[model samples]
Target: MDTSEIIGQSIALENVFRILAKVAPTDTTVLVTGESGTGKELLVRALHKNSPRASKPFVPINCGAIPKELLESELFGHEKGAFTHAIRSRAGRFELADGGTVFLDEIGEMDFSLQVKILRFLQEKEFERIGGSRPHKVDVRVIAATNRDLEKEVDKGNFREDLYYRLNVIPIVLPPLRTRGDDVFLLADYFLKKFCDKCMIKNLKISSKARELMRTYSWPGNVRELENFMERMAILCENQEIMPEDLPDKILSAGGVEQDKMPVMPARFEWPRLRDMDDRKMNLKDFLDKIEEQLLLEALHSAGGIKNQAAEILGIKRTTLIEKLKKKQLG
Candidate 1:
């Protein structure tokens, strides 16, 4: 539930954070546009978290997930016997989210008729439930997210232009993972540690070669795909390290780095000179910790997460290894 959980250190993400800081305090309707799985819902949640309505309810409904026939009643509620299934009167998302924030996800998939009601609500802050004559007013902040281009939908007569402009009062675009530079590795590490903690497993680390391959390969499914893949690895990988062989065929094929051609090498024994520290701009503790972490990860990988064997390989006692893991909070 952390507001800063939209993980990325890339400038594109930083720009989004900047915009979020400026706009989240108000009730202006925000339109979040991004490729599918770029974490649009996360962005909307962050917006609500920072908004004055943060203490209020946050209601989300997917326009694409729900059937068209039921979507109207789902959004605007219905009176008793409004439809065959409506045995009693019910409040809709808009009414339920009064004094709060309502997220309309995948708004592009919404039926045109429902779009009219949404548009009216945006204008009047009031709506009538199905089979109800009286108009119900609600003070709610609206946030909508879509992967499609609303301008194109508007031109095609699939979406109302006025609604598009109204909802797009403040626009936020999330960059896909492929374009996020080193953020791929950052997110990968974050997800790895997260899933490891969740499953109560020892720390899982990505091999440098695997990291390189991940960097080069385009993540078509973006952050969501990476998160799922890491969870799968946490449960499925036998070794503490994520190796090239462990990657999906799609990643291996896309990266085009054959494991047979590039086999793993033994750890080198290069002593880090003072010049090395100066070049890397790292202090002594950070430099040593980085080296120690890599060695520990390599040992764990070679021993397949066997603590005793890994400790023996590192020429350290089992207790020492456990202490280091604890210090690093990787346990």
Candidate 2:
């Protein structure tokens, strides 16, 4: 549902857009490859919407999620008396999506035995229900997506080689967030606006320091992770800006793709000394903040704010420290 929702002006996204432009009007089976949360489904939806089947239903099924026993019935439909629970006849995904598209997510996790059934339908454009003896044909286009390495799966004999080759006819790879240039910040801002509007909340923008922290992180979870973090930060945000201190340590500590891109973690800051603060009444937030602030000041003072040197001395995040300064109004 989100087109052009992708961020990043990097060559990676440029290439992705080029591919999308070429594939939008075709009925070819497209295999989207990337790490989890890399927006594979989003791309697939974009492709379907831009194609001729825009008005048709988009049936999405996670091959790995459905129980193997029920998977066949779910994809190919079943007669009223097909199985134990088949009290009523039902149309499966393939049958219902006759003129539209079927997105098979996590295709790599599909059971090997069931893989054969899918391959057969792909080649013949027809399938039979679990209990029905009649073979039915459909005109649905298939779009398979996964974060798994299918080549390796084929090597390990976990996936059928022919099936793998078939689905990969038009492969589209999505780059990780770390390599998407400034796209991280862009996506964060975009999602922030979208979520706030959906929830009828005030628009909030992430601070410049927060943007820097986001840019520096590697984002192992990719776009999905970024969107998730932004939504949470917006809810917890004090005003109209997302501060670095609001993010979790794990996200802040992540490394970006390029050494020059910046760190994913927040900067360290020096806070009131433990003895100077009320310890007995300190909550988890204050305690962690105290530690972060203290480490940063010590590191900065020890290394005279030479980020590299200070990092080696205190093993704290320079990006994170910079973030703390912004949050504590120390910057």
Candidate 3:
């Protein structure tokens, strides 16, 4: 419900914010394009909220949600006798949003015929009901959005070329969530607190291992998927701190299980300065091997001698970890 709520500080989103700051004052036809769940509609609402038309109606029409036959009526009203059903006269999104903005979401899915009608309204600021004769001129600003590549769609002959040019006066592109660093944890914390409050669940912090697992997994569904994942964790996690065991099955085991094509030494030690022994140079591999052995000892001590849990923290396979333990003969 908050108008200015923006998420993530990725370079792409920062660029988007720069555009939003510049365009929020002017009445421009904006085309918000991005993959689904990237917050296109939120940006549209932000535009409306920031614009001079902030007090006026900001209507949002999903071109894909309404039926093809009804979509025309949804965008441009229908006269009582327009179709066989002969429904009563209606006010369309454009008409209802007169003196304001109308957001056409999923505009790429609009039928070719309706595209021309929309283009006409964009051009003349006027339209007629489906079966009415006189044109009703309305001062309406159009902001459109879609998940499809409209330019590519036009090139493929699936979308209209004229409408493409008409609605795309200003364009904003949003990047997916995976590319956004740190924002993941930021949003995760936000959603976790929000859902916990709403659902009356206790607050929780993600365990260190769980945090590592979350950071490594690829979120294909973007922000939406991450929110859902958080909600599930909030509902299921009973303790004050969420742990790797609390995460859903797929995520809990991700990243740590992948086979290591090259074994990198994992070590922790405090020893006499090797810098003083210049000519006594040992093979770097041997130093790394010794380092790995020392680190294993530290991990065992850190884990209270629990190898399985220690292996989980180190992000290595338990068997490989045990082999390392045996090679070094460290308990």
Candidate achieving the largest lDDT: 1
lDDT of 1 by residue, 1-331 (tens): 3456888889988898988998899889999999989999999998999888999999999999999999999999999998788899999999999899999999999999889999999999999999999999999999999999999999999999999999999999999888899999999999999999999999999988788768866787899999999999999998989887687755644442333333365498567799888899999999898678667655765676677998999999999998986575335
- Give the candidate order by descending lDDT: 1, 2, 3
Candidate 2 has an lDDT of 0.81
Question: Relative to the true structure, how large is the alpha-carbon lDDT of every model?
Answer: 0.86, 0.81, 0.79
Per-residue CA lDDT of candidate 2, range 1-331, in tens? 2356556678898899889889878999999999999989989999999889999989999998989898999999999998788999999999999899999999999999989998998999998998999999999999999999999999999999999988998999999888887888778878898889887788888777667667766787999998888788767777777665565654343312233443345467545565545655786677777567656645554565465676677665777666666676434
- Worst lDDT run of 10 residues, candidate 2, spans 254-263
Mind sharing the TM-score for model 3?
0.77
User: Which scores better on lDDT, 1 or 2?
Assistant: 1
C-alpha positional error of residue 220 in candidate 3 after TM-score superposition, expressed in Å: 1.5
User: Which runs of model 2 end up more than 4 angstroms from their true locations?
Assistant: 199-201, 254-331
Candidate 3 per-residue C-alpha lDDT over 1-331 given as tens digits, one digit per residue, 9 for 90 to 100? 2344776776767888889888888888899998888889889899989899999999999999889998988888889988988579888889999989999999999999999999998888999998999899999989999999999999999999989987888888878776777778888898899899999887778767577667655676778888998898888877788775566544533333322312453587445466623445866677677567556645654565567977987889889888876554332
Backbone steric clashes in candidate 2, count: 17
Pairs in steric clash, model 1: none
